[model samples]
Target: MKLLFIGSRLYDDIDWYVKRKNIESILTESNENAINLDLPDQVFIVPRGMDGPKQVAVMQNVDAIVPLIGIDPPLIDVAHMKEEIEQEHGIPVIAANVRAVELTSNKIKTKKFYDEIGVVTPEYQILDSPDDLTLEFPVVLKQGEGQGGKDIKIAKSMDDVEEYFKNFNQALCEQFIEGSEISIEVLGFNGEFVALPPIYKGETTLEGTHPLSKVKTGPCMVQGLDNNLVQHTAYKVAKNLDSDGIFEMDFMYSPEKDQLYAIEVNTRPNGTRYLTTATCGVNSLCELVNMAIGEFSPANISDKLEYHYSTEIPVGDYNGPCPNEPVKSFDDNDFVVHGPEGYQRLTARADSKKDLDNLISKLL
Candidate 1:
């Protein structure tokens, strides 16, 4: 068997590294050949970035084609274009259909889907303009195409909402649940089967090693939150949406209300998905391949895995920490003590806030 991974250059794509690692793992387990092709980067599905004929040529000879397109919302349409091309060429493209991707990509649409399925999610509304509207204060305003928390803002007043609306073409307003945020990574095979593990992120230094700004950057550290209620909810959502491959679903659990509300769904191996490999030892990528190849046997899957929660203080901003020092303590708000290990810069999306807080408090 032969597999072709359509993605960008390895150095530029950390997620691609995870993909490469899984390819190696699958190869180790089976007698198959695999090759990774770095598709050129370009705006949209322009002809210059990828040669459709060339892809068709490769697909004709490969047993499977897995496109590693970025998880940006706009790119949903672009991936659909590639799917069309691949299917027309008689190659089995293992991808969530454009409809499925679109539903998850657009935050507004995702909210509607969740509501229709009787799944609880934060109450939200869409704004096509910065015009006047009646919404509760302290609402969460987010751009439709936002990932991580980059375009996410907590609007405290109507004036704040209007100002944020002026900053973007479209925005979403949702009731803010004051609670801990959790990212659930799910893997579905053939759009009919699914598995999920809860990845918990507390807080981290604003600066230092966090990679929230980059695509597919894993959090500093993560522990599996063995909450079956959360895990089951994630699995149900992925399946109801016909999600296949690797995807991430974010939720904010309100301890005050003891409620969990779905935030949004990412259709690709996003920064949060990196937890399965980088932090936890789930190895979701390897499972993706096994499922893709009809290896969904009972013994091939695991119902439980080791999980951990950090007892370290999460450094949100390490601006003052010594360049090569381990995080010892945050002192005078200028710098933290550095140890022989230097600074342990857990990249943004790296570790949880509590994890950093615990670590820092201990050192201090």
Candidate 2:
């Protein structure tokens, strides 16, 4: 089978799988200097948009297309392209459709969607001005579009809200829930959806800590929260979306209130993949390829599921023993070190908590 993958940033994560499947890999990158360009069978340096990749896919006669984009900006364009190409060329694009992107891309629309679906999300109000704020103090003030904690502020008072409004006129103001932060990856294709184990991100703090800066673990052991509830809520959201590919969602569970509130959804590859893979032994990126090849199914995913204790730590630099070639990617080793030099993370997994601790200590 031949595949056309857009964006080279995430190509390395699934390069081994692509090679193992003996798929002809054609990749397109907007930047000529992007990494992982040499791994694909054919590389095309195209302009920054879906148009270039779409042209290359048609010209090369690729059997399927999978976009490996991680950010939110390019998803709408990719969704548009997927609609046009899949309808006209009869080739599947393993990505979310236009309607799915439209709803999830905007935080306001996502809040409305959750309300419609009866999924509990934090109470929020769209603020045209700081004076119009109705949520209580210690609320999250952010724009409709951003990722990785960009343009986010925890407003504790009117001054903070006013300060936030100085730069942007409107904000999606959400009531802050002091609870354990969680993330789960839900994979869906051809009407089949499976929500993987939820990963425990750190607690919500008044100081507004981004989850990326905290140590995280899988099979979230939140005291009062149930894993099945998280999985069920995620599945409901994904089924409502009725889209293809990965849906990485963020949620907050308040112990005091005994509530699980949906935060956001990212319809692409994300930073949570490494930890999710370490925890469950199911790599979402590789599953995208499975979806492209007509091999993705709920039964196949269930067979591959393995329960393990996993944790990921953010270390500025890693100076540990390497496992093998592509040490950053998953292998038979107990630990996988990934990320750039200055911002690295180590993910370790084992059969038990004690074993997981030992593996992390030995590796770190």
Candidate 3:
């Protein structure tokens, strides 16, 4: 089978699996200098947007298009392309549909979706001005769209809300739940969905620090919160969205209130993949390949499940030791190192928690 993968940013994560399956790999990138271009069997430097990929897929007669875009800005365009390509061209696009993207791309819409689906999310209001604020202080102020903590602030007072409004006219302000931050990656394909183990991304702070900057651990050892509950809720969200590919959902567990609140969902490959794979042997990136090749099913995923203790630490400018070939894979190595210079992170796993602790100390 031949697959046309859009964006080379995440191709490396699944290159080994593609080679093992002997699937012809083709990739298209907006920039010629993008990383992981060497991993694909063929590469096409195309103009930005979904038009270039659509034309390339038709010209090449590729069997399917698996969009590997890791960011949010291009998802809406990709969703439109998915609709047109699958309907007009009769070629499958392994990604979220337009309806799913529209509901998830906007934070306000996602909040309403949770309410409609009976999933618990924090109480929030769309505030146009500081005077319109009804929620108490220490609220999380945010725009309708953003990722990785962009355009987000924890407002503590009217002055904070006013300061936030100076930059943006409207904000989706939520009653801040000061508690443990958790993320789960759910894989959905052909009307089937599976939620992997949860990752414990430290507590929410008054400063609104994102999980990206904090150290994260696997299997979510948060007291008073069950991982099964997280998995079930994530599965519900994915079933409601009813889309393909990956659904990375973020949630906050309040120990004080004993409540679990859904925060956000990204209908694409996300930062949580590495830790999720480290904790559980199922790689969502590889599963995207499975989805494209008609090898995806609940039984197939259940067979690949393996539990291990894992942790990811933000080790800027890693001067530590390196692993063998297939650096992204945890097959031989106990860890994987990733990210750009001065902000790289090291993720490692072991059979037991005690062994994981020792491995991390020695790696550091």
Best candidate according to lDDT: 3
> Against the unseen true structure, what C-alpha lDDT does each candidate score?
0.54, 0.91, 0.92
Model 3 lDDT per residue over 1-364, tens place: 9999999988888898899899999999999998999989999999999999999999999999999999999999999999999999999999999999999999999999999999999999989889889998789998899898999999888899899989998999999999999999999988999998999999989976767689999989999999999999999999999999899999999999999999999998989789998888889999999999999998898998889999999998888788777898887788999988988999999999999999988889
Candidate 2 lDDT, 167-253, residue by residue in tens: 999999999999999999999998889999999998889998777689999879999999999999999999999999999999999
Candidate 2 C-alpha error for residue 251, in Å: 0.5
RMSD after Cα superposition, model 1 = 9.5
User: What shift in Å separates residue 55 of candidate 3 from its native position after superposition?
Assistant: 1.3
C-alpha lDDT of residue 38 in model 3: 92
Superposing every Cα of model 2 onto the true structure, what RMSD results?
Answer: 1.0
User: What TM-score should be assigned to candidate 1?
Assistant: 0.67
Residue 93, candidate 1: C-alpha displacement in angstroms: 2.3
Could you tell me the lDDT of residue 131 within candidate 1? 69
Q: For every candidate structure, what is the RMSD over all alpha carbons to the true structure, in angstroms?
A: 9.5, 1.0, 0.9
Residues 109-162 of candidate 1: C-alpha lDDT, one tens digit per residue: 899999999899987778776564456766777866666567777777777777
Residue 313 error, candidate 1, Å = 9.3
| Candidate 1: count of backbone clashes, pairs at least 3 residues apart or interchain | 35
